[model samples]
Target: MDLHQLTIHQARDLLRKKEISSVELTKAVLARIESVENRVKAVVTLSAERALEDAGKADKALASGENGYLRGIPCLIKDNMCTRGLRTTCSSKMLENFIPPYNATVVEKLEARGMVLLGKTNMDEFAMGSSTENSAFFPTHNPWDIERVPGGSSGGSAAAVAADEAIYTLGSDTGGSIRQPAGFCNVVGLKPTYGRVSRFGLVAFASSLDQIGPLTKDVRDCALVLNAIAGYDPRDSTSVDCPVPDYTQALVPDLKGLRLGVPKEYFVEGMQTEIRDSIHAAIKKLEELGAEIDWDVSLPSTRFALSVYYIIAPSEASANLARYDGVKYGFSYENASSIWDALEKTRQFGFGPEVKRRIMLGTYALSAGYYDAYYLKAQKVRTLIRREFDEAFKKYDALITPTSPTVPFKIGEKADDPMQMYLSDVCTLPVNIAGIPGLSVPAGLPGGLPAGMQILGKHFSEETLLRIGYAYEQATEWHRQKPPLN
Candidate 1:
């Protein structure tokens, strides 16, 4: 049996029945990584030693009749999330040599559940860009076509799962970092409501907009991972105090009498014809399954969501990234005569162009003379975006849209065009603005490239979105199709 291809639920049953051991599974996964890492460039640090150790523990636990969903599962972690003693570079030279003494809250949770860490995957520097090409180490290529990008930030995690290098992986979503990549890679990625999962150990990008989520092979795995990570932590001031439901319970095939909204604003121009056709077909399938599709839904503020996200996300990022000065924990510039010079040199040498660009934009927006004109105005517009979602949710169970306007473009296709690159997240920014939940389920391929059908839901309403996505996923064969990487 190909152990690397087993989903969490499938693997758990085998482990429970003693049909397979965690060590064997881990070996199979590691071998797959070895075979594909060079071509895909998905992983940065491979924790082979640590993975084997954890797999042994899981095997012993299973031998002693101890069973857990993730106890014996091998998975990958995005580099931005701190992993104690493991290098978490965030795909930047800034922290290349820095090792955290602690694990992110999500990492700690996964470890507690018996998951084996397979090493950290690559990402855009500090999760700032739409394509993984911005990584300081190297850009992760799409497993489908090496010439194409795997989508940004969480691209490595998505590519690894698509290539079966890992059962599943964790990714952070700040303005579609998780979902967009998942969409491009033809996987399931969920961006939970902001604060539904603790951000205590996450390397911050945009604190208010940042969310940790799962990039999984299927919707069921997405739920299983979400059940393990969703909860409140006192350490995170933004953590929401709410009960996390058993997300697996939402896998029902029924969508009868459910009300779904389709905001006209999301179906904007410049969307590829194939993507549009696929989404329309998906909506039709949902209707046939008894979901009432409200085509008249309009979120007027949606037009401004991308602009608001750019302004507000950078502002928050500016504040969160201030600690990376030369004197602190990350990279530092030596041989400087003064502290000011040292700070200047460190930041100049440490941050990549994209990171520095955002910092400057944020600083400018938050400057004394322009704070009200830009930052404050963006916040007010952000509120309107949230209100729009709230009003829509009052009457609909969830909203549907294309995950990205286009399929994965060739690597370097938009590298020189910053505005074009930012457009990748245009359809997904509103969910973050409203602090709501969104899931990108693999929709049928358009022009042979994977597209995603995004389901948006109310705050903490992940169950409903999961139910909708699961039903759609079950109705189609998109999730089962593998990229032609081998």
Candidate 2:
């Protein structure tokens, strides 16, 4: 068997038995990346030297009878995340050459656990788009179909795992960045509650909505990565103080008598027939597993989640991205007559079209004349969305929906139509607005493309989410299918 294709749990077991050293496992993943990354463009930067160095240390520690669960496992970090001395371009011309001086809190925690850093993966510029097409550099091609996208802004990370370039990867989800890409790439992805993972070194998009999580081949690996990264950090005031649970220990597949809520608003008109049919089939499978499906529960605010997310996310983005002016940092214009002109010219030339549009819209919303009308109204709507999820969770163990309204579209299908592109995230935006935990697991491929089934739980209910996903994965062979990379 290819060692790179093994799950994190399996790799760790082999490492503990001295069947494989961390260095050997890291080399297997690196070799896979060398063979496939050029065609897929899944990795933007490769860190072979550092990865082997880290793996050597992990091997030494193990030989001395010291071990950690993730010690020596190869993993990729999304380019949006800052890694000291590594080029962390959130796939934008603005930060194309910028390197951070410190590691993100999550990076620090992962390193402390001995996970090997494979490389950085591509993403949408400032993580603003639903498709990887918005990346300023290059769009990551889906491993399953080279003609289609891998989804975004976490597309590269998903493609990397699906292509067997890495055992797992970390991704940030503001709206559906993690779940949508996972769905498209046929992997497991989790978006933890807001503040569940510290955001100290993440380049900001929407402060309130943005969250960091994991994408992997299965639920067990997802839980392993989450256990290392989720915790409070004093660097971020918004970080929550909840105790981290033993997520990996809760992978029970039996959902006997568990209440599963099916929201009515999610299955409305405009949804693609293939995706809708796939979700209905998944619901029936859950019912067969002893899960009771409830049909009347609804999230009335679901209809407004996309609108509210657009306004609030961009509004916060405008303020956060203000630091990128020519004077302070990143891709400044050379030899301008005046400082003001330099700042203006730098921003105009550095940011991509989609990024510039969001920055302008956010600036207008927060401007003196429209703050109360646009920004405040969005917040009020956000509260309604959160309350709806809270009420539904009171009676249901989890909620089910299609991760995206359709399978991955052609690379440029909706590139010119911003509204049509935004609609792709309609089923996913509500989870971010509500700050609850959500998981996207591969349902099956319909029409020759992959579709994902989203499982949502109440705040801090990641344990339940994994248990449900693992059960479904055990029952179906969908996730076992590989992309035809050769």
Candidate 2 lowest-lDDT run of ten: 326-335
lDDT of 2: 0.92
Q: Highest TM-score: which candidate? A: 1
Which runs of model 1 end up more than 4 angstroms from their true locations?
Answer: none
Tens digits of per-residue lDDT for model 2, 216-285:
9998899999999999999999999989998988888878979999998998688889999999999889
Candidate 1 structure quality by residue, lDDT tens digits, 238-329? 99998888999888987998999999898888988898999999999999888999888899999999889999999998898889896757
For candidate 1, the per-residue lDDT at 166 reads 97
Candidate 2 wrongly placed segments (more than 4 Å): none
